[model samples]
Target: MRRSKNRGFGIALGVAIGTSVGVAVNQVAVSIAIGIVVGLIFGSILDKRSQQQEK
Candidate 1:
């Protein structure tokens, strides 16, 4: 979707942040998992809103 054009950036940013935090806490795996989940939730919200607007 045009409105969700930055989805990849959003997800990547989320993962990066999560990994950074995980590194700080020495929980790389858990932090990455949480980050990815959060990123997906955020990206989905953006995508849905964009689609709704299209309608």
Candidate 2:
């Protein structure tokens, strides 16, 4: 449950960052897509680390 929350937060943060990058590059759509993928990856990494700590 806690891991899921972290993932959600990561996704939101990624979107925010993606939006900004998109604006800078004038590619909102592409940036958002990339952001989502990156966010998911980051979220999973975080989840793994947290799990390790818990153990």
Could you say which candidate leads in TM-score? Answer: 2
Question: In candidate 2, how many clashes are counted?
Answer: 0
Q: Candidate 1: which stretches are off by over 4 Å?
A: 1-7
Q: Per-prediction TM-score, please?
A: 0.69, 0.89
Write down the lDDT of every candidate, Cα atoms only.
0.80, 0.88
Query: For residues 1-55, what per-residue lDDT tens digits would candidate 2 score against the true structure?
Result: 8888878878888888999999999999998998888888889989998999999
Give residue 8's lDDT in candidate 2 (0 to 100): 85
Query: For candidate 2, what is the lDDT?
Result: 0.88
Tens-digit lDDT track of model 1 for 1-55: 5545656656777899999999999999998888888777777778888788879
Candidate 2 wrongly placed segments (more than 4 Å):
none
Give the Å error, residue 36, model 1. 1.0
User: Which lDDT value does model 2 have at 34?
Assistant: 81
Candidate 1: deviation at residue 31, Å? 0.7
